[model samples]
Target: MSEFAFEVALCALLERERDEIIARQLGASVHGRRIMDIVCVEPGPDFAKRVAITPHEIPDAAIESRAGVGQARYYRNCFDMHPDRARSVAERAIEIGFFERVRQGSRLYVRQTARYPDEWFGKLVGIENKPDLAVPGDLELQLRKDVSLGVFDEVILATESYVTGAHLNRIPDEVGVWRFRPETGGLEVVREPTALDPAASGVDIVDEYAGRTDMRVATAAEKARLRRRMAERAYGKGWRSFDLPPCVHGAAKTVSGADGIPYCEWKESVVNPAEECGPACPGYEPADPPEIDIEAVRDRRTPWVANPKGPRTQSGLDRFL
Candidate 1:
């Protein structure tokens, strides 16, 4: 079906109720605006009986169901209802912030922050916000402007890497001396061990590591880009139980089926940290190596991922079959 056709089908399916299902599917994209709720485009002849929506303004949908592919009714509703548009109905999905093109990656991940509520993110996968890592923006805007507070009093410190131009460190604690610049909107935390205070216990600044100090500053856009990239990196997954996805760099073994066809290994998790299943499947066991002919495995995968926006579905289907 065309994107518009699928959207109309989805709307018809959700005409009465189905928001919980919608929220369940499209909730985790972090970096850009995704259609969390139905955006009712301006009504027209094509939208007569349905609740037409354009998820994040992408021609494709923000959510799909494993129950069935291209099954519009099975997946519908905004998982992250934009606060500004929280009160809106399915008919007005647009006008909240539907940029046609997003600069970030495929998925939209909500920024991990203490301020994010369970209602907004439904209990994020990881509670910790990577310590004091900051998104690219004006960190210390001086809420009062005139009522200056000590740089040490600031709750979080956001900075850049001295060598890699990457997000390497977050101090997250007490340091003896620090500086904040109003003109450049930058922060510097210093740990000189001279005058013997709380952090000066070892007092080995000049004696131990003299030139070990490092500093870095990155532009706001650069920091935002960095955070976006980090969010996409899959990590800390419990390999067993089939409840979590494997790391992007992880390798999984494949095998041939009775029909002599090889298939790539794939697993889906409904819960988390799945319990060890014992001798049979062994919850965390590495996938089995392919039992198929070597040439069969080599010839299976297409050069690229299947693109829905691409044309010639009939030819594509034949290649896979």
Candidate 2:
């Protein structure tokens, strides 16, 4: 039953009957990040939570050849460099929130703002989770590298078995076939996927492996700017942002069950919050991890849709690309 509990029970049945925006694992982080066992997304406008991508710490083509470009260019022509590498890349982009320090009049900028979206995204899809399609591992070289990297506009495969016909002649007829059940959350579909364009098909910014050093060759405007930075990082990371596991008897341990899932209150059931929970789990020990709050952890694991660009913020990327 583990494929991480059938991928968190098909991400709790696609977050209770699909509304969209889901992320689990995510794309490659160079050469080691093929995560993707679920991706969904499809609401529209959230540009990674309204845009804010600031850090250009030097080299917007060398500040667009000395500040003569657009977006009202100035911020010392993109972070007036060499003050210790632009203050160490603006202090590591303001400690990872992605740059912020601003002033304007006396001049002191380091912005990375983002609220871009009149329609920043819609229809991304991707899913792969195979709860035993008769154990097909490289499943036809991973659905032919997801239909030759069409940055997912449909790539599905899901499964929990029971939909044979020789398993659709071993996958990849343009990949698409669900089945999932997770005891009654259901999913079916069985085949109906084929949309991918990625600006006239061109993606795989590197993943064929074999003495690779983060390979490259991406253009269709670099796969539409890395498909909008992987849909703005799957609309601000979801699919249960991993990292859980902590408990072998250190109390406060783990336990959420029902639809909130997550349970391993000392190996009693469901665990794998990304690879079998904690201390290098041999059913680890020492625990203390379930206090759960912040509005019941945003109504149990947020599923997107909270001001997704409602009261007119800005930048709908020129009306959805």
Taking all chains together, each candidate's TM-score versus the true structure is 0.17, 0.33
User: On residues 1-321, what C-alpha lDDT tens digit does candidate 1 reach at each position?
Assistant: 222222222323322222211111121112222111121111122211111111122111121111112222211233345633422322232232211111245422221111111121111111111112244432222111101111111222212223122332222222122233322334355432121121111111111125552223333443333222222111011101022223331232321111221122233322122232223333445544323342232223311111223222223333222
- The residue-by-residue lDDT of candidate 2 on 84-173, one tens digit each, is 576555555445444456667775566543323435467777788888767647766666666666667788888888987788877777
Error of 2 at 21 (Å): 17
Once superposed on the true structure, which residue ranges of model 1 sit more than 4 Å away at CA? 1-212, 231-307, 310-321
Model 2: how far is 2 from its true place, Å?
8.0
lDDT minimum window of 10 residues, candidate 2: 55-64
The candidate that wins on lDDT is 2
